[model samples]
Target: MKKTIIVLLTQLVLGLACADTIQLETGSFVTITLPSGWSANLNTSRSNEKVYWINLISPEKNENAGKIALDRLKHGWAATEEKFIEHMSASIERLSASLKEQPVSLNELKTDNAIILYQVLVWEKIVSMITGAGLAEYKGVGVIHIRYNSGHTAMITVPIKTLDNSNELNEILNIAQNMQISMPLSENKEEESAQSSIQITQNEHGTVIGNPDISRVSLLLPSKNYKATPGALAIGRGDPGYFIGRDMVANVIMSGWFSPIYKFKYKTARDLWKKDTPKQAKNLEYLKIKEWDVMVHELEIPIKTQNTLQVTLRANLLEDGTWIDLRLSSMGIASQRADMRKALIDYINTLQVNVAEARGFHLKYTKQGVIINAPAETPGSLFIKTKSLLLQKRKTHIKTEFFLFQDSGEDIKVIAWLRPASDYHYANVKTLWDETRATLSGEGFTVIGDTDCQKTRNWDVMLYDLKTGDKRTRNVNMRASCVSGGIWVDVHFTTVDQRDSSFLRSKLLAYLKNFKVSDSHVE
Candidate 1:
């Protein structure tokens, strides 16, 4: 009796191993075996139509459900593979068009035709019946589709999940790629012919857009096409230079004054006194508008293709902590009114801005300034201003300004500030400094100089403590006097606390390490 019991236990273990170890590999010949408790039923109707056979199989609990599905498909279509694919495509197109909603852009395509198989997984449940007795129920179901034709086929299985996680969905795709199909059906010549009858095309383009999801309007151009200069405004100018494509030209501008508020005020004064234009007030809302500092991008695309083609694309970012605003303006001959409207809508829909993976900062834009709120423990804050210009039929100019503030709120830090030499003719240095003082005062920094720093050819750095309104200056430097055509400014800060000092130092180092010169002029 003891020997018999041990032998039975060994058989049970062997059965469990066999069930888990089953793998099917199909290339030219088809052979598959179901695990224990699973069964297969073959359909023999269209056995001669190049396709070998159709089978319905499932675990014991789901056998009935699988049979019912097989019955439905068998009754519906007795056509060749080519006809079936046409029917399927037509059905999908009809359903999509009937809804009268924008269809999801189907941008990628792959085809395989080596083997085809169908699988269904069912989850059973026990529920109380109307008669008060427990009844068996089919709670959920998932489908597995396998297709093979012309030496290629895909075996994809959907898992049972209450909610789908895209990351997990990708894992499922990986598993499908790894699955071995045991019985390779004869090449489906009909399927190949059907695929040849259909033509698919894909178009991809990159542009800058505002991603409201992450806040902040940012430049979302392709990573390969542009490089970022982190600290200096002159460095940031390189991005616009690199933004070149067929029939496209881009320019960059960087300006710095005591504050954007004051910059606007100066512009307002010039527009009022010099130009005598009321439009200056409207310009104030967009230009010299504060919120986190702004970066503006302008893209011009000329549609040359005769056939209307759908374009789908996304920007790959090289850095974090910046927001994106994308705008598109069309130039040249072909159908400007309609094409511009369509391009604008597509550009707007494609905008997506989120914290860069390196830094999880949420960028906010307001009329005051561009505000960057870093995740907890982040070392600093960034305020930016961005504006744009489109020059006639061929040129695009983007201007950006950045203001770096220490997250500690203790010491004041000024990064690079660049101002165009040509613009100095119109600039009001006194009002700019006064406006900067007023803004800093609200942030707890007391203004020191009564005269304009720009007039003295010197820039001031102001610091304040939250506990008291007392203000102090760590350093004052001459303006970009060394700067010839364009200016470059760099602000260095040392925190009062040693611990905070290390954090600030580390951030500066990181910024320098990641900074790269933009290659915009390369032909």
Candidate 2:
């Protein structure tokens, strides 16, 4: 079977010198050489089993009835050689029937590296689905399936008029035969030289944006045809690590935001402003690439003076407490959309994120001048600000909260409250703890006894044994505090059962051990 496939493909094979590689948004890659005057566009925004499709347009546009396409198989549909041929044949037969053409023959050829299946359909006048207009000639469909040894398979389909047009068919088949497939390479594996790797720290693999002093990092971008630089945006930029991308002529501008993942409260980019701009905000795709979940959205943001700018926002969500947000904006009209999309995809393909260095657990609140470190795998949770008159002379209060998830139901909540000495005057750290305890007691919270108090060089600590007096769900809660001259850090731990509470308490202490508060306050 393999011998027949090899002989058939060897007979129709053509050679090309140069090749272009395309990285599919679905975490696969394809490399194929194109014939001169032929253009290729990869559609990475498809919401289907086919991860993406590469559209190949021939130079003889007037003569060719349809463009050749290579679609990457996904969802375990073409995982094996048997499944690859099974799905490809099924698709070809279904498509032929829909076009009202009889399936002439389905031939299988096997090469040393891949399994090939080609089918020729009966010629028929193809009607345009959009305009319902008849085509100039009767179109014959050519469906080819190429499954490489690397477990990557792409189904190639093109339009053919007759068997006599072997030149075009051979060219299309040659592209399929000579195509190369591989898995996406990681930044650590791909970049090894000192020139390619940015080494501010041993773990840092990519480039740093905004202020490197704060330990902000993101993917390393290409600097040949594109220019990258740190910049301030209208949206208050320094902390989020804002950077700009400019083309050779500066016709297209790209703004990127890279920061700790905890800063983004929303699940997806569309959720950021979908409620406000329902009509203008459109989610293009959500792609899962290795350890990252990328959410892409297209927005028509209105600028009061500039009318509107076409914006493409890509939110790259990394599991290790970091995210990369990129916005590609252009003032070009709708007609130039195709060109813009091609440029966007091509640029995105070049990005290689340094996952090892980018996954950081340290978070700094520049405004409050506070920095806190969490468990390596855990990211800080969202917080809702609230005001309280706990202190007698309370004029200003700021709180930072983090809910670390240990397991499915186990959670450790940590809240840090910053108050300058100018606003509240407490005789000692014990007085601050007394005020906080009184506030909780007034709010219908019962304080369990056996509480321990310790005086450390950094702060006066008060640890609560257990606080539980509610008709709500059954839960075990332990709250503690480390109060300094002007800084107060509250550590709250909760679990479903008392047995689990002990295990969670150790995790909470580990976080508190690493936690450090600087002498600087919000004063």
The local distance difference test score of each candidate is 0.27, 0.44
lDDT of 1 by residue, 1-523 (tens): 0000000100011221232231211111223333334443333212111112223233433533221112111111123455434433453354345323344232122334222333223223211211112223333223333323322233233333333433433333333333332221224444222211111112254544232233222334332222222222111121221222221232111111111121132232323223321211111111222222121222222122322221211122222333222123333333333454444334334334434342333344333444443333433343333321100011112332333332211222234332333334424444444555576578764433322233212323222222212122122211112123233222333222212323433433333322221111110
Residue runs of model 1 more than 4 Å from their true location after superposition: 1-327, 334-337, 340-344, 355-523
Q: Which tens-of-lDDT digit does each residue in 329-423 have in candidate 2?
A: 55455455556656665566666654334232243333222344432443232121111000001112233333222211112333344333344
lDDT comparing candidate 2 with the true structure: 0.44
Collision pairs in model 2: 5-109, 5-110
- Count steric clashes of candidate 2: 2
RMSD of each: 28.1, 22.2
Going through the candidates in the order shown, the clash numbers are: 44, 2
